[model samples]
Target: MTRCRLCGSEAMASVVDLGATPPCESFLAADRLDQPEPAYPLHLRVCTDCWLAQIPPLITPEETFKEYAYFSSFSTSWVEHARTFVADAVERAELGADAFVVEVASNDGYLLKHVVDRDIRCLGIEPSVNVGAAARDAGVPTLTEFLSPETGAAVRAEHGPANLVVANNVYAHIPDVIGFTQGLRALVADDGWVSIEVQHLLTLIEENQYDTIYHEHFQYYTVASAIRALASGGLTLVDVELLPTHGGSIRLWARPAETAGEPSQAVTDVLAREKAAGLQELSGYTEFSARVAKVRRDLLRFLIEAADRGETVVGYGAPGKGNTLLNHCGIRPDLLAYTVDRNPYKHGRYTPGTRIPILAPEQIAADKPDYVLVLPWNLRAELVEQLAFVHEWGGRLVFPIPELSVVEAASSKEVTA
Candidate 1:
């Protein structure tokens, strides 16, 4: 009965069914494990009319993100990515002190602080009261509220139009994506720009990045779906650039749809690539279902084989993507031993479905497990570097999705069976 959120089309078809996975961001306290944990289907559907791939609501925004566990400042590369984006956006926009900047879903003011350091006026719209307070402490003005059309208008009336509206990896988290995009249009000035970074759907299909599909993430978008979504909300996709982050992500630049501008060649090239990859049709979405199943099977097989050999395996990070992969494969602490995370919020907690014990990253050095399961596989490079010392103990790292393989710290180039 859930119509496509983008186009309101009734011709939505289920493409991939990850049956009843626990909420990805829901980490559990020790005393709460005895209590029952709830789960909802990660059944992915694509609109036949708009070609927008989405998941029907299994959980609400308040349930998923109000008091979130993950923090962007914990990741060094991600902070640097934000710093770089702030610099680039400021340069490209020719922004001065008079220009206002706003970031949606701004976690802990990681990006906006860079704006503030440059003496630019910055504001953050974060739904999580916890992180919003953190941003305020960090010297960035933040409003702890979910962005809606009405909220957008209020922000514009008070602060005036924003010259740069930045949303990084938060577009897919929105359930009412049209309303979210409309918020951008309602706040941005005619000459202003809105840049959104989301994981590209083409990469999700090609590289078996189904771990990125979680309950909080309502939709998966390619340039095709994103352009259509933006256009419908009164915005134009004037440019797009592919980045190596998050398996593969694309940064989309937009102006008011009525504003005069033509899409850059990068946008056209990425669209061409998506079309060549068959993203224009339903077959492309369907082909990914079998790949998801294969990843689940292969990862379980690798963990089982490692256990039989008496080799200890522990996980590296407790990211939301890791939770989906852990639940879908039904992996437990028995197979994975325990997972470690840099974020203190999750240190004493446990992963949602698989009930894997979460520990501090230092525990890995004390235990020196034979293998480390890099749960946030997208951050493989950064994690591998941080935990590189594990190699001194003859330990290797495991990349679970796309295929299960071992990477020896001694020989990072070689993939071990």
Candidate 2:
């Protein structure tokens, strides 16, 4: 944290100190409940020189990804997003059957299945053994290996350079920002396109999405800083697309410097927006910590009030971000009761630090909790529709981020903060 991960600058400014929490995805089994758990400082800092927001590399990708619990296929909306992205990328990149596509951190082949459907030769470099095996079982050719510079070169040398390299939702996971970017550069053809999607720091701050801050995400990016990060590996920012995934994300289209003519007008527009938000300077981050505090306070107040009223409250998703929210707000099983998730892997496991019991999604319907706290608020629209049946029991859905919001399950109307 003393030096910026992207730039070696020693001048780092505090963004928000989320105190300490265990690795967000480290769900505890029943036997481990009595054992001691480790925690790390979760402070976020921005490089004054590069304006790149990052946390200390207390945990390594190997520790987190080797036996990963998260599988992208569990979320239907995310799967559809990947399908649509593959179609769009294929058309945009002019990829054909003979073309080879590579995806970094391709979790459970959520995306490459689309590429395979089109008869396009593709490979998935996935770090997680379990999820990677699942990907292979799903008929997507996957390499169970992390993407280092050497790994990238070996892949290119064996299978030939990739026509399109797709990295979505993982650009922020690696601690070695520069080396990971270089690995990406090594995977793609000299003139090939590299499509990367990462959560935009602008929406993260603007929408009070502090829950997204966790150990897994090593760094946050603004277009201004992203341009600099991409340049470190000889990649040039070409075009950018603003996406609605994971609250808000940026789909960065980049290429090798030699063939990357000039950045699109979209890049200019996003940079302008970032600048207008004062993200290039300390002004943009000054109010974020206060806003994050308000979110925590508002959420805790609602959960406490609900418990006082003898009403039941449960969480909807056991996402990593939800752990951060639960830990930061000091919510335990007493306040939330028990949360339900569609992912069966988390059904019998307890949340990392908060120790909230995770049940199957059917538990919500079976128990008929008065309030269902939506942890993965980024998928608000999708979850709201899916959980509409909660209204049958007069249940309401509570969203903790972007301010506390209580919406009627049936009418989908806002109740109160």
The candidate maximizing TM-score is 2
lDDT value, candidate 1, whole model: 0.89
For lDDT, the strongest prediction is: 2
1-417: candidate 1 lDDT, tens digit per residue: 368888888998888888888899889999999999988878888888888899987688888778988789999999999999999999988899799999999989999999999999989999998988989999989999988888889999999999999988889998888898989888888889999999998888899998898988999998999999898779999999899899999999999987838889998899899888878887677778887888888888888988999999999999999998988889988899899998998988999988999999999999999999898888878877887898999999999767877898655654775
lDDT of all predictions: 0.89, 0.94
lDDT of 1 at 65: 76
Q: C-alpha displacement of 172 in model 1, angstroms?
A: 0.8
Q: lDDT, candidate 2, residue 181?
A: 91
- The regions of model 1 sitting more than 4 angstroms off are none
Candidate 1 lDDT trough over 10 residues, lowest sum: 408-417
The segments of candidate 2 whose C-alpha lies over 4 angstroms from its true place after superposition are none
TM-score of model 2 (CA atoms): 0.99
Clashes of each: 0, 0
Write the residue-wise lDDT of candidate 2 on 72-126 in tens digits: 9999999999999998998999998789999999999999999889999999999
Q: Give the CA lDDT, 0 to 100, for residue 131 in model 2.
A: 98
TM-scores, all candidates, are 0.98, 0.99
